[model samples]
Target: MHEVDMTKCLLISLNEWRDRREDTSAMVETVHLDVGRFTCVEPDQLVTTYNAAVQGTWLDGSRLTITEIPFVGRCLICNGTYDPVPENAYRSPCCDNPLEEIVSGRELRIRSIDYRSDAAAALESAPIQRQR
Candidate 1:
């Protein structure tokens, strides 16, 4: 059951990029995936799945870079904003202040794609993954 679900997820992600892939005008290369820290996805697991998913498809030979989104927030006690380190590095009283709401680094998006198009072809590529 887990395997099926994971494959499905991988297929969907690839399909999205493939749908946006173009030839004769531009070539697909990098796919930056925005992986949220709170998204509950294991980095190593995702990497393994993503690598397998891109196989035998148009996304083949392309690179998938997963950018980790840190759990950053403002310190409620001190109002100091900081990027969340590892659990061991997490401090409740940050700079003597507690944390409150986050300012950024929670969203996952395609951001932008790096591709080129010419007069002869009208190819364009969309970003695969990103977190900003």
Candidate 2:
């Protein structure tokens, strides 16, 4: 089920990128995704699923970069922000209060997309002119 979800997310991101670009000539080079620690999705498994999903597609050779966001919560009593330990256990360091507000750590979305520009590709294929 997790693999399916990851695949779906990748497909959705690719589709969105295509829609925005509207240029079929553009090829994706890298996909940057921000995932929260609380999302419970393993990075390795997600990457594997993404590779499988993009197989034979325009994004086949694209790299997937995941940035993990730590679980952060705000203390209601003292208005202090901190990272929750023990995975989902939110206990305020100040006043020993329960954290009721989540500042972050629930995100799962694409941050940005990198495309293989024509000039960049051309430069790669260009011959090297080394100076003596």
Candidate 3:
């Protein structure tokens, strides 16, 4: 399911960050994910999967923050943009027309990462050098 893919994505991101910093000792505090309404991924399930996948890894004990993007659409008939309510049969509120273009609600990506960079801390503690 999507959980597998989501877990993979998170691992890939963590790996890339480690590679860039060349430090695997840093602890990740939180991972921010931007998910759209149409991605159909349940927040709770995603968290569980991520936690399980990150066990025994550097990302273990890290928190996950999910930001949901609402389902938005554009009505071709009235040229109106609005949030489609599933209870209302996904119709445009302004013109009562079917949504023609999906303006949003299909996104699933990493928004940002919060981590304590070990390299930065080491650099800060190191003595500064001046050149003449």
Q: Order the candidate numbers by lDDT, best to worst.
A: 3, 2, 1
Q: How many residue pairs clash in each candidate?
A: 8, 0, 0
Write down the lDDT of every candidate, Cα atoms only: 0.60, 0.82, 0.86
| Number of clashing residue pairs, candidate 2 | 0
- Candidate that scores best on lDDT: 3
Per-model TM-score, in order, reads: 0.55, 0.80, 0.81
| By TM-score: ranked, best first | 3, 2, 1
Candidate 1: worst-modelled 10 consecutive residues by lDDT: 119-128
29-77 per-residue lDDT for model 3 (tens digits): 8999989988888878898899898889878889888999888999999
Tens digits of per-residue lDDT for model 2, 1-132: 575787696798688768776456778888899988878888878888888888898788998899998889899888889987764456787676777898999888889988866766778899999999
Candidate 1 structure lDDT = 0.60
Model 2: runs farther than 4 Å from truth?
1-3, 117-132
Evaluated against the true structure, the overall lDDT of model 2 is: 0.82
RMSD of each: 10.3, 4.6, 2.5
| Candidate 2 lDDT for residue 132 | 100
Error of 3 at 8 (Å): 2.0
